[model samples]
Target chain A: MTTIKVNGEVNIQPNLAEFEFKEVLSSDPSRKAVFLLLNNKTTGKAAILVADKNPFVEDGSVINEWIKDAKLRNLAQNDIYGSYELLMPEKFNAVKSSLIYPATDKHILKYRRREVYMIYETADDYKSITKPSIKESLFNLDWVYNFLDHKAETDRIVFDDPDPNIGFMLAPDLKWNGVDVDNLYLQAIVVRRDIMSVRELTGEHIPLLENVRKQVRRVVKEKYGLNPNQIKMYFHYQPSYPHLHIHVINIKYEAPGAGMTCIFLDEAIDNLKIWPDFYQRATLPFVGKEGDVLLNKFREAKRLNEE
Target chain B: MTTIKVNGEVNIQPNLAEFEFKEVLSSDPSRKAVFLLLNNKTTGKAAILVADKNPFVEDGSVINEWIKDAKLRNLAQNDIYGSYELLMPEKFNAVKSSLIYPATDKHILKYRRREVYMIYETADDYKSITKPSIKESLFNLDWVYNFLDHKAETDRIVFDDPDPNIGFMLAPDLKWNGVDVDNLYLQAIVVRRDIMSVRELTGEHIPLLENVRKQVRRVVKEKYGLNPNQIKMYFHYQPSYPHLHIHVINIKYEAPGAGMTCIFLDEAIDNLKIWPDFYQRATLPFVGKEGDVLLNKFREAKRLNEE
Candidate 1:
């Protein structure tokens, strides 16, 4: 299994590379990150949506049922808006917490439905169902990668990273000592089952992939003193997670700068440039420091359980 | 004798592949410019020390006698402290017109002496003199040539023209506009005798050199508007007229703005990279347009006399 580490926190997932992560509640930092894992039903684990609280109920199915019920009532609200921020209990089965409201006043019943969970049978079902989405995340990742590699070159050029599993891009907005620096972009596929299955297919060792992620986190934190905000860790086919491989992605949007740095594909980068389709377009919202803190807490809890 | 033309202007030096022109001192809208002529010495034209503005005195004998007279009287007041500015006209019978002063207050008479019509005994005599330089006006033409040849490039960078004879450089002191347009370095070398000699030695024709300078100028002006005081051009040896070659270089000290166009050296600038040493260290000065007006007026008067 590929273990993706971001800013020193480890995230475990199944062998599949594609995944999407997001934040459903505006107030909860621990539950701030939500992920959508997808692969063709022919190859990937069954689609399951997990909550920080009720890990088994699958929030994806609950959200789908709620949407259908709301449509029957002809709610006439744009509930499928890409992003909806609300205040509520962190999880589903928590003792009756006061219903949190959205910025708009319309949804009293929806407010009572605080955190919904659900599941889907196919990739198409997932795409058709979710409006505020994680499915389109991978496509955005590909776009950002293309832009960073071709046009962003300054008088001083930076070298591209050596690993194919891990792609690191600097944010255009980041700066050091008043000089604009690029924000970082990183991607890696995670697996939960046999690591050898991935190695035989992609010809890359799973341990090497994990090590690269750890190195990236150490370098970024120690050298740049910043963290990714939208972290996407994709997992498929559960026992929730132990049966899955987690592919981790870090994306920081609205990064603070105007400079762009190109990732040159030279002789040194030849081998890394050719990657498998599974690793293509899998993107995650990079969790910045707050998200990183939650991830570290999760990793510590998992490590203690294993011990 | 490969004449390189950027647009339509013909550069005259084999060493120079481009020219950029700017008027350093003009409130007028016309933006007229002047070119300095170097190596204009004629074999039989009587290099004279004009006590009463005569042009027919002996080249060496009369000059030496006059220098002797000034040296004896000014040995204490002039010799120990006073510079070439004080002794040049009195001793050598050369005019030190107030046309070519730099922006600085502390002027060096030694440098200004080079501005006067000093004779080069032989090409080697011209080669040996250092303080009163004649090399830059000859060398920077090579730099300009390299700058224009799409194949021209070198790790060697220039902050200021090394050879005053080859040409001069200037940048706009931008205050009103928030944007810095572009840094401009200009050089013009006038060659009647030296061109003839280099042609014989290198087996190259002279007209090819003339065409290159004109092309560089046209490209720069078309790309960036011919803004007054935004740039400056220096004529190599304008004291004597006719045969002239110039190297004009301009680089933006600060970015003008987001939309401003910068005439960048194309990636293919390698032609002048392999030139021989005939164009190195030529001496010339970067002077302003007030000086240009005086020199232009002088050239017009001489041209009228010739006609």
Candidate 2:
């Protein structure tokens, strides 16, 4: 394998992908970077989706047809939960995709999930209910990962369901949902066994989250001792997650991205059921704080014009 | 005023702001650039909300009380609309704001509006009941100014309220709402007399938009021969414009940024009515495509952390 690096100042069009990937590597690194060698996918293309990330263009549009490859990597059981939703040049072959707001079901291949196949198993034989949310077969977060991670752990946990399939851990830490989670009485973040975001959502993954709403409802009503109407279970569009989790908060509480950036799990599920094409047929909205990669993809695609 | 130019490969942190402004100037020119002079607003700060025009940061979170001056410009009536929402350093003092996804009213200074004190009157006085949709006002789409400047000659105008207080221009452009407008239906782009975005929506602007829904309902019913439900009015989060405009489209149409990037006019109106602090109280979520400035502001503010 050859590693190609483009350094120094260069005009955008010819060196666009290399220039962008260098920046992408600096800010985001969940996926490996793809190099443009002589026989590379984007060798002659003026505009190409260099990696499976968002659309990174040299200018207004493209000049050539490009190919992409999976920057493959190996994962341990601990990382089995991460959303490997990286797009490859090959993905477009499976579907008719658009850089402009994913226009059709054919564009569904845009939501690429990293290859995840392992089922993690902890050293100890997993118990049924030491805690409902803790799945013994999942990645264990440590203090080393983040010095402030302990702050989240110290806060009260409303509920924990220990099933590996529907495994989850609950925390009423103010960090998950919004800033006023404690003050406004908004709610907690319900972390799952996996560490991923909504981009990984698909028909196959839909069934995995099947009981999330039901389980959350039952526990909130009986275990947490709260009224069902006031409790709300939702997901932030571009949620900040070390691990993929859900937010269960009170409806009366108003917080960051609450209405705009979030969607009710019930609403998401209903949307899925009504439109069988759900993930593919419907338009999945994402909020990038402004200069984010995903949002840039839309801009480069010309779907969203930046003024 | 001193103009600072940055060129070639250099370590950031040192010449960060100048470096950033160079790139900003390269892509978006609607907003002026601010250099971090020794006594600059970002002199000692790591990250700063330099100036809001969608691009937010120079690098990291901020420090120091920054000062801003308006980069004045000359405007011709022909060059009516354009990106006039860049927040100068001076705007923050007038408003209370937050960076938690545009949460507090503090960040409210970001939505800067150009001083549009004049009303454009077409040569014909904007006759009523001409056409439902016009191609002119949709995206005038000039690299610089808004072409809706020529109101009368090109298309049909249903209503052009001369009062700048209730300043709104209505045109039924099938393009304003969705792609297949002829068969599926009705539309309008309610151009506000002033240059601003939804984030600039204060109580004062509400009165201007008051009769819009009522007027559209009546006209689409009487003139266009369409049901009021078929006539839709909405707002794009990041609309293409020189001034703020409302998208009045049909409900039957399936289009881009439907759920994620749009808010219904009625919903915005109700939200303002129910909560007088409307813009101040709620969190404003933005979709950031790679290299966007405002989204960068959030990242610099630490509201959006890259993991």
Candidate 3:
């Protein structure tokens, strides 16, 4: 096995004994990667190394070779796809290494199982369909409150504005691996608890929206060297949580759940400026995933047709 | 070389000489794939074959072997990235096959070169920045008129409505290669020439939007067997061309240029129905690519900050 050291440490052919084991920064089971922070004892400097398993080639010869050499322990089997832990002999090593089989696609679509339905939500539909669903979910705000109070993810917070009405705390999203700057993704959760979603926003909240947008851009520029033009800010209509938040992502990174329910922050502010009751009076279209409570409610109300 | 035959023709070991070349369905140079229609003389039936070059394994040995044996003919070199034609010896054959080098990424992003800027275009900005740029470009409509007149893509038309006020012609988008139903993408080009973009849309055009939306859904359902819930319909705020069109795509397919500038057709109709001059009164936010005239105008007018 080759000992590869990245981040300015030379001696690519150094023996594995020369390096001291450190801590694992992160591990992604789906991608079969373990990011390690190692110290090169010879150089007395820290080196970052990504121990990632190579993907199988699509060639028949490669597949046959893999099948011949692999000892698989089945994890699960459902229909056409199956999951397993493959223990295989390394190229120049006697020891077998274990890797998860049925490796996830590189460009993973998180909502592949979820079918998106565009629901034309009226104010009445909000009352009958969305509002009740939100109430039923009874989303606890303790975690959010903890984060705002500096009891959670304190070290991860990039920017924190304490002005209750127009303030938000920006932090790196859990989806990001924290290594790749190209795929930089962040989320800014509003400090105000009153506004649950974009549906509740009016011209009165334009300052909050603008503040988040401006501060996010400035902080990203200062910290990450990414220009304002190289970043995108948008709010999800049917967000994972009902709490009002804005997603900030590098323009180069194609974030999942971007197009379906995403509404640009600038567009939202512009609309509110034109008509203070724009979101209140307008018929908003949102994507509802399969088996969602709100989706069922929409179907029951005849707002969305039964499939 | 193994002559693999697909599409239920059996006899995977058939000689290459036994198959008669009919025609090429599509050839993607970037992906090094040639979709060919072949006739199996032995079976007396047509067969589809995709002759694609396998992607390189990220292993050091594989890359070293590739570099040692492959012959390259340079196409172009710009900075770090270069394009080439690779002629390499086949595994078991004396014949050398040709393939384009620097194979494009499978999930190809179209706007890598173009920087996306969120330009806030007010009514005045539209007149000063957008209108002049459109006028300056003088986008020729002869081809569009020709298509409308049945001089082009007549066979490709999936749905056609003749009402000039509320009519549109639906056809497969150029981006989608016709074979893959999972990636089914279509465009509905409006018949009326007066309405140029979403900016020009008003409450009066609600009927037209609804008609297009309804007929498109019906046609996709009838012809493609795609449920209304299985497809997404949207309009690009800053469309490729000035002429009005709505993009219809399979909800499963992550279409390029989707997340950016895409507004739901349902939302547009709902907005128009509620506010007679919703689009007219709203300040629009759109993405502007590098070197775009409107982008330059926006920069000059201070609508978008200079980067």
Winning model by TM-score: 3
Off by over 4 Å in 2: A1-307, B1-153, B156-158, B172-192
Cα lDDT for residue B160, model 1?
A: 25
Once model 3 is optimally superposed onto the true structure by TM-score, how far is the C-alpha of residue A177 displaced, in angstroms? 3.7
Q: Where does the lowest 10-residue lDDT sum fall in candidate 1 chain B?
A: B45-54
**1 against 3, candidate with superior lDDT:** 3
RMSD (CA, angstroms), candidate 1:
36.4
Candidate 3 lands at a TM-score of: 0.67
Candidate 3 Cα misplacement greater than 4 A, ranges: A1-112, B1-112
TM per prediction? 0.16, 0.31, 0.67
Compute the lDDT of residue B7 as modeled in candidate 2. Answer: 42
lDDT of 2 at B248: 64
Off by over 4 Å in 1: A1-115, A118-142, A150-208, A224-307, B1-307
Query: Which sequence of candidate numbers ranks them by lDDT, best first?
Result: 3, 2, 1
The 10-residue segment of model 2 chain B with minimum total lDDT is B114-123
Instruction: Name the better of 1 and 2 by TM-score.
Output: 2
TM-score of 1: 0.16
lDDT of 2 at A63: 8
